[model samples]
Target chain A: MGVFGHKTVSMTAKIRLYVDHPLGDGQTVPLDRDQAHYLFGVMRQQEGADVALFNGRDGEWLAQVTQAGKRGGELTCVRQTRPLQMPPDLWLLFAPIKKARTDFIVEKAAEMGAAKIIPVQTEYTNSERIRQDRLQAHAVEAAEQCGGTYVPEVTDLQRLDRLLADWPSTRRLMFCDEAEAGAARALGAAPRGPWAILIGPEGGFSVTERAKLHGLPFAHVVSLGPRILRADTAAVAALTVWQQALGDWDGPQSD
Target chain B: MGVFGHKTVSMTAKIRLYVDHPLGDGQTVPLDRDQAHYLFGVMRQQEGADVALFNGRDGEWLAQVTQAGKRGGELTCVRQTRPLQMPPDLWLLFAPIKKARTDFIVEKAAEMGAAKIIPVQTEYTNSERIRQDRLQAHAVEAAEQCGGTYVPEVTDLQRLDRLLADWPSTRRLMFCDEAEAGAARALGAAPRGPWAILIGPEGGFSVTERAKLHGLPFAHVVSLGPRILRADTAAVAALTVWQQALGDWDGPQSD
Candidate 1:
């Protein structure tokens, strides 16, 4: 393995897998039936193939397929390729929209480095509940595709009022308010230790909800632009804005 | 009409429609078969219903439905609600990805105020051609949904090399390079004139293509972040970064 071992592993491995097991040198990781089918049935990987693995805690590891079978498979870690790079302590709190768009939001949030994803139910939110497991799987797949080691947890849907009732005092909320369109308020001046971005639904926040959020000391209401963006587009744009202004985009890679 | 006349029209009209004809005072606009079906059959809009209309030229108009039928309809403009709010002189040049994701990019680009959209084919670009008409329709739909008065033109697929060969010298290019991940370079200092953002395909630009981009005088290579973003996510993020830095996000609504 060269220098940081990233070059060697990246050159040898074409597929990145996320697992729940620990990653270290000479550790054997058994693949479940679904993973076996994906490796053997879909991807056609056989024994002795190099696979990159990450378990969200121990960084990334280079593993070799030792026992490949139709029903199950096993891989032994050869070396550590990368260390875990934790994202900024940023949470994305948004009113869930439609199914595909909600999934898109979760996946983009994971790729854009939102440490936690929470689905909030506002008065105008169209979605009653979200499939947390499915959203979590999307987050994992997004991390796998985007070469991310950490997967943001997708929490179950909670009421917006309730979430704000016991809001953490230390965390600042960047609320993307549609009513604030054309306003020049940005997140550039906001202090950025811990932040959460709140995006409303398609119909936007109710008048009372907006008043409550505006009254909160931690909420920094900002406009996305002149146009009123859809809930999903607003989520991605909010995350991008937060990442650029207050997240890790300004510094070198910590890992 | 209450200052901008936006409040009265928006409060009375629940549906916004994009038309091809010019919109002005007392102007009668005819609707096509598809539009008529959408208004009558799908949305159940009846005669005398108020519908907001924008034709990409004249500002927005509050129109009252005069004839509503299954195959055709007509609307008479009552008054101009808002002026034609033009986006900044910015274009989005991106290599097309999957179909749905490509649609998503165009939609978000329109919502984020890209003046034009161009699909470029790079060395590693997977798509050979894109349906320009379909993408244009998606832009129109996005504008309609996002309450935008302007719709960005979706150009047909063009080769990256040829486009760069005759690239306009006045328009600056924000090149998002995957290899430059974790770089601290940003668009904060860039000027606010004519500009464009270039996003590579999933496989990214080949070495030769990247070198060529880096060699261009107008190109400014920038990194999205540490984690690699997909083409769609990169497009939105790049737009957000550019808008926040040098686009219309900081200014008041300009009509």
Candidate 2:
């Protein structure tokens, strides 16, 4: 595009951007105001600077910045560095707790390679309504920071009953139950399929909800151990356990 | 000790406290100003109410409040509830990052079952010094919050070289290196023994440091995965991975 072609320096920039626009070879990706400010004003990128772009569809592309301005910038794709590596079809379904912890859950979920993030309203869920846009932004930020090509979608908050009613029989649910503490089974032995990890809120699931979940055929009730983990900690632990056991942690590409 | 015997009602109190004093049958534990304010003023607890107490040595004990005051208070120990279940001999050695992230690391490590927490100074370590006392307090608070009977000690910051020089031959180190990012081997096949998960700083381990670590016979280098995790996220992920692999995650008591 300018001083050096993307093929010449394929592995130069560490800054990876997650864009919504389509990407391909020779395609010029336009930057929004925020991304322009970040690239030009904050990171102080100049013309011909190398940048990596991923649109969650195509593989990561090494792009050369052709124009740099405070209000607008453009980077033309040159070469694909990596294929679109999707995370395992794992879903993180958690009851929203405090605001910061909720943000943390979404961010960590993205980093740990959850395919989708869903907020469910349990009886004990503290937050009645969630800002889906804010959480989705956090997920995008996490993906960008973690160098992940895939960005998990943050679904709007739904009632726990509705979610269970519409639960896919093929998708197994790993129900994190606090009442059944210390009664957890080894996740390593769990059957591999579409899986979702359900973490409860601070006050935990109500008795009626627990009963309904216990009766659900698709729900595989498991405990996080003897310690009383907060909802956020439980989310991370559950994801880690699930990933290590059945997710992409042990996949060939990971190694 | 006052109105109710230790065996009177073991399930009455949900409040748990981490006291600095020894606890035993009929032993009166003194509460400081802060504890007094929290119990009496904040929680509105009255004399003769039951409280659970753990001092990191004895098992958790059910204690009864005997004296109520604005400045000071006392509780008489009744009986032990849960034994002092120690975490595995797994230590978390990490280069300190930002203050809040470091705190998050300590808290998560405790909640996730780390035996010892050590902050090491590496070549690319950003924080030159760490508040050992504050971090240790965080460990305690995490244990308390997670209902852990045993608390992991947060050791003072030690140079990585010095620590490696005096490394115990019995302990195996799971070195998390960014250079070997996608080339990480599975931790499942790692030999079980005294173990420590060493996470580098924000800038990652320097070349010389990585070389030394790779050359060590006791070090088993592993990667977190393809995704680039932050230092704090890496610590939690490493601990979770190790725990799910060789720690007490699959132990009989955990279930």
Per-candidate Cα RMSD to the true structure, in Å, reads 3.8, 5.3
lDDT of 2 by residue, A66-169 (tens): 98888888999999988988988889999887788899999989988899999999886768999999999999988776677899999999998998998898
Model 1: residues with Cα > 4 Å off, grouped in runs: A1-9, A181-186, A252-255, B1-9, B181-186, B252-255
User: Positional deviation of B186 in candidate 1, in angstroms?
Assistant: 4.2
Q: What is the DockQ score of candidate 2, to 2 decimals? A: 0.29
Give a tens-digit lDDT track for model 1, residues B76-145: 9999888998899989998888899999999989988999999999887778989999999999998887
Clashes of 1: 0
The global C-alpha lDDT for each of the candidates, from Candidate 1 onward, is: 0.83, 0.80
Model 1 agreement with the true structure over A1-255: per-residue lDDT tens digits = 111101111445778899999888899999999999999899999999998899999998889999999999999999988889888999999877778888999998998899999999988776797889999999999888777889999999999999999998999999886556644335677786888998877666667988898999998888777766777777888888787777888663232
What lDDT tens digits, residue by residue, belong to model 2 across residues B8-27? 12244677789999988899
